[model samples]
Target chain A: MTKKLMKGSEAIGEAAVQAGCHLFFGYPITPQNEIPEYMSMRLPQVGGTFVQAESEVAASNMLYGAAGSGERVMTSSSSPGISLMAEAISYLAGAELPVVIVNIMRGGPGLGGILPSQSDYFQATKGTAHGDFRLLVLAPWSVQEAANLVQDAFDLADYYRNPVLILGDGLIGQMMEPVEFADSREPIKVLPPKTWAATGHNGSKPRSVINSLFLDPEELERHNFHLKEKYDRMERDEVRYEAHGLDTDYDVLIVAYGTVARVCLTALEELAEEGVKVAMVRPVSLFPYPSAAVREAAAGAKAVLVVELSMGQMIEDVRLAVGRSKPIHFLNRVGGMLISPDAVIDKIRAIEDGSSEEVRHA
Target chain B: MLETVFSRPDALRDVTTHYCPGCTHGTIHRLIAEVLDELGVRERTVGVAPVGCAVLAYNYFETDFHEASHGRAPAVATGIKRARPDLVVFAYQGDGDLASIGMAEIVHCANRGEKVTVVFVNNAIYGMTGGQMAPTTMPGQVATTCPLGRDVDMAGHPIRVSEMLSTLRTPAFVARASVHTPLLAVNAKEMLRRAFSYQVAGRCFSLVEILSTCPTNWGIPPAEATTWLEKNMLPYYPLGVFKTPERGSREPLPLEG
Candidate 1:
């Protein structure tokens, strides 16, 4: 297939269409509106439905119903938008419904500026809504990777019968790059039969119920345990990361993800000119985070610098991975601001120069 | 030899319900079950239960059911119906669940004219949470939250949902009926039947608002609760058809010619 130029947001939308996800319910939010815009036009052409929901809250609930009916459905929003979807996301998780959510994250504790930030690291991976549940969170650093990961997300969601999130940021959503399209005619990956889908059993099979309410305390706890077991399998089998310069002896290791990871890649190359042997580890799946990869990448490094758009969120995960063995330094740009490669290089120099106690908990 | 006058609808579970003795939820539940059975849509029907007294509705209905968060039944039903247009979908919601918290979901669903049936039970007060005030609670009515009779100035006048929704140009069916009396119960069931039939015909968005009773929460006898609903709730929330979209075309009426 010939590769075509595309924006990250549009690529994701196109990927969903190609992956046979014809149902999309979404609300417009900054840095991610192109996705819904694309779907609104494209889905109808393929005999699909694209509903611009009244709010992210409604959009998420719409996903719950669509997934329950055994159809591939998707939704995309920014940080605050995803936060608004917390209630329905919990329902989807508890109900074991398969749906894909794309978080083109922007800065926030509350309506932080809209440019782009990785502030939602904990929200996406750790927990956003209530109950003991987990979403398979995938982080992609480039337009091509974002598109590919979205297609993979659909398959993974159905395979696990759980929500799968594609965690991106404003930079990726706004940037343009070449990406290969999945041929729409090609068959998608087959998932196990969703016998429990409420697809009008034709009065032949038993009624199909899609519910999350477990009133009996023991019954609820058993459901929780079942979710935990599924998460354990995901943690074991689905960890994805990129280890750069780890094979060689490097003085510093940088932990970053999504857009920040792409910027860190450029910084590492520039540092090579100055004889600053810097390696990097970029987490591909933020949830079930690539901790083992972080451990391996941190080995023998003098210090690990974690770069992010937030003040310090992913850094906490990095600290856990390195844990007292290596000094962990952190740097960020918040409130919708994008960090330049030069700014990252400056941080690397400062950490190397040992002139700044900016190292978190230093 | 004699024949039975009544048998439980095949759509209702053999097990008992958890609603209080005086609650009208059981009566309404039976109505829906009977409709689904009569239409032969029982197996294919999917009901989205609400977050009020009917939270465990999945246990009562033999057909598939989903428990929605407060006021989100409409949104959830939209999702299910869109994904499986062939399946019959309905939402069972109460006053607090629909009028109070899920107002947006319901309004948007009504406006978009989604192909789904909504069984809205307006009992005037929050029953599951021990008789709290609801968006539908009438003026001069009292509840746990309103130790004094509801003050119109402080608490605001009650919202008439069916009337408000009738203003929207998209719905195929919007009606308000009651189950407070035997005659009204039959009328309420007929509205529900029309709502489900509209959905089955693929005519978008149907909702039937039922004037229900909360005897336990209202501090009245179960029989008195029905009389109370007739006397107090009827005048405030008048019963009748609010909106009905044309069956000829399911598309939104062209922005007024």
Candidate 2:
């Protein structure tokens, strides 16, 4: 199949449509508006539905309804809009409904700039809402990867009966790039029928109820334990990462993800040309973090440098992965600032020269 | 064989309900169940329950159901109806759920003319949350938060949801009904049947706002609560059809006692 030139947001939308997702309910937010805009135009042509909700709060609930009815549904929003969706996201998790949510992140504590930023890393992986559950968070570094991962996200959500989050930044949503989607109109995996869906009974079966309220203490506990088992299975089977320069000797092992990892790749080539060996581990999944890969790679290096677009949120995971084996240095640019390739190379050199602080505070 | 005239509706489950004694939620649920049975749409009906006294409404109905968060039942109902337009869908909400927290959801769902039905039970005060002040709390009505009776100067006037929703541009079926007496209960059931029939016909958005009694929260006897609702709430919230598809006019048709 020939690669088509497309905007990152549009590519993600088309990928969802090709994955058999015909229902989309979203509200417009900067950096991710293209997704809803594309769906508004694309869905009707394919006999799909696109509803522009009054707010992200309503949009997410609409997703709950659609997902409860056993349809492949999705929504996209920016940082502040995603905060509005937090309540429904938790409800979706507790209800064990399958849905895909895309957060093309912008900066913020509240209504921050519309530029590219990875400040929502913690919000996506740790505290998406006030619940003990977790979203299957996937971080994509490039437009092509974003498209591919979105298709996989739907399958993963259905496979586990959970919500899958595609964590991107403003750059990934707005940038124009060439992406190749699967030509065949087939899903990546054969999912089981949603027997738990709240479609009408038709007198052939018991009434289906989509609910999260377990009033009894023991019953709620049992539900939590049931959810924990699914999360445990994800940790063992879904951890994904790409390791570079780990085969040869390296002084600094860089840990980064999303667009920052793409910058690190460029820095890796530059450092190799300068007779400096630098290995990098780019985590593809943030929740089921590549802890073992970071630990194993850090074991072969002298020190580790963690880079990101926020004030070092992922560094905490890197610290947990490496433990006290190696000194971990942190570097970040927050509030929509992008870290350049030269900046990453300089950080790596500083670590190699022992001039950087032993422990950079997050 | 003995004749059965008052048997349980086929749409209702055999299990017992958790509704408080003297509460009208059971009566309203029974009316809805009867409507589903009469329409012969029980097999393909989906209900969305709110986060109020009727949160467990899903358990009472044999059809498919979704329990939505507080005030989000309309949006959830919209989802179900949009996903499968062939299925009949409705949202069961309360005063606090519909008029207070979920105001935006209900307003937008009606304005969009979504093919769904909504049952708004306005008991004038919060029920499940220990009788707090609701958006529909009557002036000078005592509640947990309004211990000294509701002060209109501070809390403002109660909202008339049916009248407000009827002002929207979309053509819909909007009505306010009361179930304070046996005669009124019969009228309320007819209003509910019409609301569901609108959805069954896929005609337009429909909502039936029923004035109900909360004997426990009102601190009154069940018999006195009926008289109290008629004397106080009925004067403020008159029973009427606020909008209809046939008329397409904003003039309310107030019913005579």
Candidate 3:
């Protein structure tokens, strides 16, 4: 397929179609509205289904129904919208239904600003909804990756029979980059058996029931335990991360994800030019967080600096990964703001020069 | 061969119901199941079970069931119907789930003319949560939370969901019926069957609200709860077919868009 320049959100819609996604239900929110808008026009042309749901709550539930019925279903939203969809997300996970959700994260503790931020790291990885369940979360650093991961998202969702998330920021969704589209015919079509689908009972079999209710305490506990086992397997087999300059000793190691990883890469080049050795570990899969990789990288570095566009949300995860083996630092800007490469480089130099004291707060 | 009046349809599973004794969820569930069986769409039908007391409906319905959040069943049904136009879809919800937290969802779904069905059971109070006051609670009716009687001045007026939904232009069918007696249950069943039939005919959105009874929540005997719905609840929420577009019925002006 020929490559074309497309915004990250638009690319996601294109990729969803290529992946045989016939249903898109979403409520428009900042930075990612183009995803639903694009589908609203394109899905109809292909005889697909697209709806601007009443609210994020409704959109997510619609995803549950379509996905449960054995269709390729997706919904996209930002921070506040993702929060509203949390309850449904938990239910989808509990039911073990395959679905894909895109979260173009924006700022917030409440109704925060509509610009890009990575403040939802905890919410995405730690399970936004109630109960013990994990969504396969992928963090795309560029528009091209955003498009490609969406296709992979569907495969992973179906393979695991669980919800998958493509976690990006407003910057990734809004920025335009060249992307190679997947061939619509080449993508996998591993539909569940007809007996599993709700496609009216033809003389072949009786009706099928799909539900997530385990009212017995012991039975519910066993189900939860099995969920933990599945998450554990996903953590071990599905973890994806990118490493730069982990071969040599570095004065500072940076941990970042999504668009911030790009900023960190640029900072790494500038620091190398000044004879300061800097390296980074970019997490592509945020949930099965590249903890071992970050810990190994931290083992050789003098200090670890976590860079994000949020107020130290991902930093906590970095601290947990590094433990007390290395001192950790944070560089971030919140409320719809981004940390420039120059600012990150300055923090690196400060830590190197001992000007930045109190390495680990805790 | 003798024909049975109330045997469980092939569309419904043989699982024992989880509903409390004399609770009307079973009757409503049976009505919908029988409708699906009658329409011969049980194999290709999807139903969304809402929160509240009917949360486990997916277990009883032999067809595919998607459990929706409180009051969001219509929206879920919309997704299923839109994605698989060949399939039949419906949502089952309660008063607190639909008229309270889910008001915006059901209202917008009706307005969008989504090809789906909704089976709403309005018993005037929240049953699953131990009998709290609901949006449909009568003006002076007493509930666990409204022990001193609901005050219009303090608690505000009860919302008539059926009346409000009928005001929307897109819906093809909107009716309200009670299931306090066998005769009333039959009438509610007929309304439910018609709603599903409308979906099969590709008419428009259809909804049937059953004036159900929650004996435990009402703090009265099952018989008295039926009496309460007739004496007090029915006056506030008159039972009838508010809108039927198939019969050349249109929603009143100013509210239709």
Report the candidate with higher DockQ, 2 versus 3: 2
Candidate 2 error regions (>4 Å): A360-362
Leading candidate by TM-score: 2
Provide the lowest-lDDT 10-residue window in model 1 chain A.
Answer: A182-191
Q: What is the C-alpha lDDT profile of model 3 across A1-362, one tens digit per residue?
A: 78898988899998998888989999988878999999999999998988888889989988977877788899999999999999889888988878899999989989888998998988999858888889999999999999888998898888778899999999998998899974555434454553554555554775555566788999999999999998998898889999999998797899999998899899899888888999999999988888999999999998999888877777777888998888788888989888889999899989988887634566
| Model 1's TM-score against the true structure | 0.95
> Tens digit of lDDT per residue, candidate 3, span B22-63?
688888888888878888888788788889998888888877
Q: What is every candidate's C-alpha DockQ against the true complex, given to 2 decimals?
A: 0.65, 0.86, 0.59
In Å, residue B106's CA in model 1 sits off its true spot by 1.2
TM-scores of the models, in the order given: 0.95, 0.98, 0.93
Q: How do all the candidates rank in terms of TM-score, highest first?
A: 2, 1, 3
Give lDDT: candidate 2, residue B46. 94
Better of 2 and 3 by TM-score: 2
Interface RMSD of each: 1.5, 0.6, 1.9
Candidate 2 chain A — worst ten consecutive residues by lDDT sum?
Answer: A181-190
